[model samples]
Target: VAVSVSATASHPIPSTLWGQMFEDISSGDGGLYAELLQNRAFQQVTPNTTAALNAWHPVNGATLSVVADTVPVSSALPNSLQVVIPAGKTGPVGVGNEGYWGIKVTAGSTYTASFHYRFPTASAFKGSITVGLQTAIGHSLVSTPVPITAASTAWAQVNVTLRPTASASSTANNFTITLDGAAASGQTVHFALFSLFPPTFKNRPNGMRVDIATTLAEMGPSFFRLPGGNNLVSETVAQRWQWNATVGPLLSRPGRVGDWGYINTDGLGLMDYLNWCEDVGMEAIMAVWSGFALGGTSVAEASLGPYIQQAIDQINFVIGDPAKSSAAALRASLGHAAPFPLTYVEVGNEDFFASSTYTYRWHDFVTALQAEFPNIHFIATSNTFNPILSPNPLQYDVHVYQTPTWFAQNSFFYDGFERNATTYFEGEYAAISTNSSDIFGSPATGRLTFPTMQSSSGEAAFMTGLERNADIVFSASYAPLLNHVANSQWTPNLVSFDAGAVYPSTSYYVQKLFSLNRGDEYLPSTLPNPTGTLFWSVVRKTSTRQIIIKISNTVGTAAPVTFVLPFRTVASTGTAQVYLFPFTTVHDFDVWIPNRC
Candidate 1:
């Protein structure tokens, strides 16, 4: 059944049509080995099989709602956008809603809009902001407007840059967010959010510029399962993702309306995604959707105790001990009082589409959050996996979007489950094609790829079969990490990068070459000859026998690799560290090339 046919992997110049598919390779525990180096780089930003709906401003809030329709609406603000008079929203109820906010744009793509303002610093205060090109249905495709003025009233910010002009078209299905409040009315100014940015896709920011620690060091992510998949749930229960209306000072944080049709701009909440996983090092795995929901709704089991006290106040505001109270005064008003190591939370996300996450309104919020955090670590995305929906020891969190050779022929479907020390969390997998529509609400259509890389090297050959089954795959990422490449609802994404520059994919160098060439230990032995498209995997370092090769060809063509020395007396003595991720190339987020003996 290798007889298959596919058409539109589309190519005219997808950076010079891919390359070499396969050749020589042998080694599975046979002491896995490969000594071929041909340009290797690394990066991160792959995850969006379904979960980042309206994933803007980090995850939920900081700013992003700039718009303009005009009429007393500060003449439709835009000089890259800037307007601040917020001493107190006044004069006609802050000029009713205002207008102008449809940012879908994407003609050559490279936008970066902004907004945030405040006035009255007296002899040292100034203000201004304006950006143009509207007219999808409203107006102002530049009837002249592009002012952003402000030195500092305190807020300060009004960046604007647009290149849209190849006759400029395709707003990629028109969108809107426009906002304006009649210039300094009653001179009490107070409009805090505003944004617009496209073409950063997956690295995040569709309607609000992003910079989160240089997009998490080119997404060299380690683990960030937080609020992932279904964006951590909230289609109902009166629209969730609250976390105190999404944190401070950006209009005192009050932005939610999102299941991802648009309007999230919470600038990403929960202490700005745990200080954005401590500025890009990553490791937050914070899911808490429990209490059941995809849409089936459940709090039963005699009111699953306020959904297990909102999962113990979202783990005492992420790792407790902010000092105690009001979640440690909202973590000292978001400047961080510390406390954010979080082992794992993950209560719900896929909630079994509707089977209800592990039962009883999600196993009583994971048995009252492991009975009040008894050493953390609790997960459960469920739709299938069931430890009887666990009531105690947790960790399941699976999810798939399918395709790419059925994810390289089932990549050994969990080797054979039943590990009972129970563990695994691929969380949200991908490939998504066949039209991919079904994202929770079900109807089905995805097969993955909202960004690009021939479907992220078939999701880097199923993350090289989840790093040849890391123990049993303890953690994994790649689920709606982001999407804004032209209002992209979802598609191939794994580090498209922005701001300065970034680009990774050959499926994010298959976990940046298996998380910087891992090898804690795993070497049974015996493998060689599955050469359909080279899929090597082995690890050994019991002190230092060295040896850790992880190759995944994904059959694009060029792979004349050669290796077979499990240790016939260590000849060709140590040393070899290849990390190739080519198929025309863009992979340079990690890029490491070292091979000598």
Candidate 2:
């Protein structure tokens, strides 16, 4: 390939070009959020069955049942685990929770354990409650006794720390809270809002899992599209993600049923996301629940007034004056006196599913939101110019899922877009299948369980075009950023994890390479054949006085190529860094070539 090093810079590369998109498809509460105990709060749970107490079980012959307490621990949590110790029981008897899949116990690590408890009626039981981390076979790894002196009917919280002396051999472990059966015979106690957290990512309370968060941080992302993808919308308007219900103390934040059919603890709420953005040094691409749902329901235009107001309040909570808006006041009360930095507010997620009604919905929302916060950019999530949105959307979020070959062919997808004031955010894109006819079908139909080398290379080729047209494409991100290995609804995520280990896919490294080595200016170079298996992009870092060239080879066989620099002073001994992905292997290897001209 011949590089036009003498040519002027074509366009400046966007800083927001590479980032991540997050939603809870069993990825939160149990995946990224550090809390280990699953189904801890019993939010939106029906009492009195094994299914209701999904993760909790009786220990040492103690009878366990989930009960609806009249005098609940908090209004946000109405259900609690009712434990009855039989009169003849002698050893420790209470309840144990099998964490999301299993609990990982590490030696020399301290864990924070807490729970709320109350007696249904007055009792003379004065024994201390024991919290322990144990193996699946009931062998205690660590235990601590927290004495409870209050015998009143009112609820009380117990906070204790468990320092494990030894790590369990496997992730098949459990967190247990028990009482001495002899000391409190026939006593019935109700427990609510139990939490057990290992050392978090940054040691922030209710923070993210250390391993998973560190992996994402290594990518050097510029933005985070959060509170998730289709997980933002629901089957009905009433069930959509509510910003108000996701902020403040966990005791006050009533959890909801996520679009993925699991009870979201709301432990990782709006404030948490903003904090994550700040910690990671990234901007927030916040999405509001537009008046549409995934189940083909759109709120009437007349009814949109309230929903629009809700969106306004949501925005205010992020970047409003506490003296004026109540939502901002709430934000201040939660200790974020200063407004969170926000630039892009996505109106909805993938509204192309309900494009027929998005015309007015887009008009009503954008018209109101723009009036309130004119500085913020609002992104429309519908087909471009299809069903035509009013006020002419300044930005559009485009999503695509296709085969590897399809992605490579669509490298020039954005080259044909009109060069106007309008921009694009390729919000979600992935090579999910090998079969063109059944891209969204099952694994038997060639769907990928994890991203392969061919798929990653294909995505890299398309990203070159995105960089080539940087002036038109403002930002882009890989969707469904995380997935729980044992409990995943979506296949081929960027990162996958179990309770103990994290697995980053090939696509992850491709994103990392581009993001970490991003240059300030795009360099015009000799283009590859339009219908070839090898493609490349060239960019220049003005500050470092270095050039970055990215190449992707989709086939297994090596295709040799050479570069010719047109610069007046070419370096005869510069280094060449290559990230090679062989088609047959899932792993990537790095090759460093020194003294290369």
Candidate 3:
């Protein structure tokens, strides 16, 4: 609790509190006010999850599979594979709703298809498992069906060998591996941990595709957040993002249940995400499946080894070299014969829901990860846990979702936080909705419209809170970026784009504009809550020594404040670049003007 001090007759107001609010600062209240300026007294959250598949470098891809057995609600997994080998039926194992299936290859090229599987009983079918790769003529073939004869019950493995057709070596080929009649026989067929490759993606080898390659290049985004929301963990630890189950060939491994409301294609495995990030020049921030999943389930202290080891393997795959170890050998087969650089390893996402559950994991992962790689920084999902100062160093990841006015009103929310050396990460803070504004409207509307964009005044006030104390906030970013309006569980992404196009919302420009224009160092100034009808803030860039005044008029009127510069330090004088938000608006492409979906 903070010691309170109020406006009393003896309350000494310093003649000039620029150096320090010395007169009032000495009182505990001054220190309380100082808390606002500290970076953060706890952990820091960065952004969203980013993971992909690389036929070359298979890490978590081998342990997990994002399957799609139904209509994709979001970026769930690939579409379900259909049998019957109809002449033109085998298209893609279909991920992202993109019809590109597994890779097509050359004749005599030794290829392996490995996938994870869990059958209730091996005796149930006692038959060969069916798997296929679609052909160029739009026809599907069940060419690589491996026989599952001698195997244990429950969690099991299946592998199939296939030599590429005379067609091509690097072109796209559709590969689909499915448990033949397990499900039909009323047998529970579970698939997780699967993959397929020719010993070459990781440890630094080539693994990329022209189609996906094209999509990524166009986004031209500076960062890539993967693993996405909910997919990292399920309603329980049983549903955690298992990284080891996703590598190897497409057979042997069976894909698992996906939290994205469907089975995952596992198509976009761990290595895939990293490769995507690498291909797109995105710095990967690997977020471990924080203990808390959607519903109520997490890793108990006794059963965390698998979880902990998975973290180690994830780090190893990202930084390990190519050689003979099981993991390294797998990488060689995938396509990558090299290592991808890893800097940040986040422990969880939005664990505020399960502070008790996440606290243990967050604390454990931080210590273990830090001890293994001293150079790496750990980001925790909870803002209350700071591994750095708690006999250990940790950053509290912060996230806020609110209306622009709420943001404007809470601009000073961090003011009373602690002043420890511990830091913070503004991992995710964006206004969003999973719905497109089309509401039951026709298909002619554009994209969905949410109240995401607002005047710079609110941003300025918020950014000032950050800049005045940049020491705490190491970095920050908005979440649910790149939402395909047609299907999104989370809406109003930072930068929305499609196969052939990209659109930067007003919020995107706001981030680009402020973050780029800010000065080297920040000088502080104060704003009294005048009229209590506006949000105001100012920051003095150290290098340029220019003070940027940001004011947001929430009272439906231009509530202006007198401009004052201590040394007349205003850069170009009175008028400044002003940004505004409208009383009404929507974000839809011209063609879908009213569709809003």
By TM-score, the best candidate is 2
lDDT of 1 by residue, 160-276 (tens): 656555433433122122223244323323233454445432343321133323433453556665554554466676566656555564435434545655444354566655664
- Please give the distance, in angstroms, between residue 303's alpha carbon in candidate 1 and its true position after superposition: 16
> Which parts of model 3 are misplaced by more than 4 Å?
1-224, 245-256, 279-282, 321-341, 383-393, 432-449, 452-460, 496-503, 528-556, 559-578, 581-597
Model 3, poorest ten-residue lDDT window?
16-25
Which TM-score value belongs to model 1?
Answer: 0.31
Name the lDDT value of residue 2 in candidate 2: 41
Error of 1 at 553 (Å): 9.7
- Global lDDT for candidate 1? 0.46
lDDT of 3: 0.47
Clashes of each: 81, 0, 116
| Candidate numbers sorted by lDDT from highest down | 2, 3, 1
lDDT of 2 by residue, 398-442 (tens): 998999998888888898899988999999999999999999988
1 or 2, which is superior by lDDT? Answer: 2
Worst 10 residues of 1 by lDDT: 27-36
Error of 2 at 95 (Å): 0.5
TM-score, model 2 to reference: 0.97
- Candidate 1, residue 203: lDDT: 44
Better of 1 and 2 by TM-score: 2
For model 1, how big is the CA root-mean-square deviation? Answer: 21.0
| TM-scores of the models, in the order given | 0.31, 0.97, 0.55
